[model samples]
Target: MFSYCTDPDTLSGFSWLSCYLTTGKHMAFYRAFGTVLLLLAITAPTALAFGFCGARAARSQVAPLRWFGKIYIAIVRGVPDIAFFLFFVIALDQAFEWLRHQVKCPDWDEPIRQGNDFVVCQIAKMPLGNAPQWVHETYGFFLAILTFAIVFGAFAANILYGAMNTVPHAQMETAEAYGMNRKQAFWRVMVPQMWVYALPGLSNLWMVLIKATPLLFLLGVEDIVYWARELGGSKTARFSDYPHPDWRMWYFLALLVFYLGFTKVSEVVLDRLMTRLTRGQATMGGEAQRKAAA
Candidate 1:
């Protein structure tokens, strides 16, 4: 990255370190941190939306819808995350390609599964083989996002379903007494109040989501952990410009600090949010806030 980076052999101490850190690979390593943050930003809301739908479905008057929601929560929450991540990404990718193959390769007689291989026409590839590197990366990242959402959403649904029930039945009755319909009472009364109950669980889920970002590596997204291992692996002068001993421990220590700091910040923010949500409400948290104020 620097003009002096032309000669890594002569550079030493801080000078060598600066150039090494500013190399193209290092830039990518830096961007990997953003990738992790971006995953969290997008996945959190998407999962929440999925959870909301699932929670609502679980509580639906229609038995089929309620059953579907309960089954979704049960199955997803029951699965181990690593197993699900491994299975789901391949299954979802193949499902997409299979659907596309049916449309794009209708004339072909070959079955998609040839013992162990999933073969589809070139055109049916998720990101066509000829597509840019970014397209492939984006597609993988999208799969990662979807996988994260599905897994986390089920847990969120369970938390939300419980939270919804925790909201007093009398509150719903009061809304009905005021001539509001069931839907209106749910939206205007129960949903608004459930957040206070859900926040603690959601807060923990957010932290878990943060920790789970490393699983992106398994999905083939070049996440921070991937870059850390790549960059920190011992590089010899024979093969590369920046030759260094194995620094993975140091790299991982940096990651440890980053996650710790990120979670700490999340905790502070969630705590303040909890306090705000509880103020003037009827829960124990609200009561405590009131007592403290008095």
Candidate 2:
């Protein structure tokens, strides 16, 4: 991308490597790594929020709300992730476009789904056909994030729902005896105690979520996996600057290291968090801390 790097064939040694690394596509590749991190950063909390709501709804007094929550959690958790990711991306995009078409082109009468093709009015396209490339990319990335949140949210809901139940029955009874109703007891007694039990399951989910980030490429997002293969594969003289032999093995090896390091760091942080949350609780962890002090 640099001015001096324009004539790549003439360059060699350090200059060739420098030019090759700074190409426009390579810059995009670097940004793709950041994109993966961004997806994880955004998805984790969003999924947690969704899971919290779903878990609460699953335990709701109202029948319809409880059914909705239970079904949402069941369907997502029951489906294989690869199937869900592949299907949801297309389903979500079409669902958005279908809604847009209903609002924007109500007079246009045609089967939205005709045989294999899912069609919408031109103006109703999710990003609009005339939108910039970046807009299209952004829309795809946002959709991937939503799909991920929905899937992981269900997983979290199942874990949290169980965790809520795992809290001692005595605690809820004590709260009720102290003039707290079911609603008050749940918020005051059950919710706080659920986290210690929830931590272990959620920790596993966090690691799985980290591993699943590579699926961004499957969702049509230009993610790190896409770039790793693109940049690392052998490039002929006509195709790329500073042509290289196959290096995908090395590229993926780096990815392996990145994930392992990330998982290690997550384990350390979660262990400390679990210790803090378990303090003074009736669990074994809490009992040990109590004994240590005594």
Candidate 3:
């Protein structure tokens, strides 16, 4: 917004473009890019934590825990991720509201599921109906995060399970022979050793997670994709100050470049992490590192 921006009809070329890009809506659009990054930053660690727990459950001595873990991993992998993303957001939202309804409205006679509608008490409405706009947005984002974690956690569990198995049986046996308990063996020998094997699968999962960020729009989160579509659509004089032709193609191109750059940076970082993890291990990479050092 400069004085020239006051007369858009006369402004053209780079001047018009500069004024257009500096609009308040465009600022929001730019912030949405940061939201995407925030989602990834939050979801990655949360999903990994879920995966670690699921993987541990799958390997648990208790039969029921193992069965539950196995079922979670299997069912999620069997379904399309988009399907899960759609289903889980609704299901989880309802589950939370239902629990809240029970606690907050104990005397309510109406069933939560009256035919197809998921009815809940006013108190149980997510964001409480009276909450601020930011609260609603935050709740949607939280749901998206949960959905992402649930879906990707299963894949991570599978990867970690295989990695755990790849840890040498001899290593565990030696740990036990040294009077280490099963937990100790797992913590000291198996867990650390499995990282080298798991890194490749986990790295791929990270890339998948990055690409899947676009699905945040489906979850009702104001993610970058949502902003891109909203801002890139053809605007009219009646609706916007900066009306233009269809620009979705260019917006999507920007998203593509952003993701490519993100993935490239992740690859570089993960490669370095893998190199660090492989050191002093008995794997091929570790052996190679040792030889090179020698």
**TM-score per candidate:** 0.95, 0.91, 0.95
Q: Write the per-residue lDDT of candidate 2 for residues 1-294, one digit (tens) a residue.
A: 778897888998988888888888889988888998999999999999999999999999999999999998899755579999998898898889999999999899889889999888899988988999989989999999999999999999999999998988888989989999888998888987888899999999999999999999899988888998988999888876578899999889988898899889999998998888888888898999999999
Task: Identify the leading candidate in terms of lDDT.
Answer: 1
Select the stronger candidate by TM-score from 1 and 2: 1
**Clash count, one per candidate:** 0, 0, 0
Write down the TM-score for model 2.
0.91
Model 3: weakest 10-residue lDDT segment is: 72-81
Report lDDT (CA) for all predictions.
0.93, 0.90, 0.90
Can you tell me which runs of candidate 1 are displaced by over 4 Å?
Answer: 106-108
In model 1, where is the ten-residue run with the lowest total lDDT?
Answer: 72-81
Off by over 4 Å in 2: 1-19
Per-residue lDDT over 1-294 for candidate 1, one digit per residue giving the tens place of the 0 to 100 score: 889889899999999999989999889999999999999999999999999999999999999999999998898755588999998899899899999999988999988789978889999999898999989989999999999998999989999999999999899899999999988998899988899999999999999999999999999999899999999999998989888899999999999999999999999999999888999998888899899999
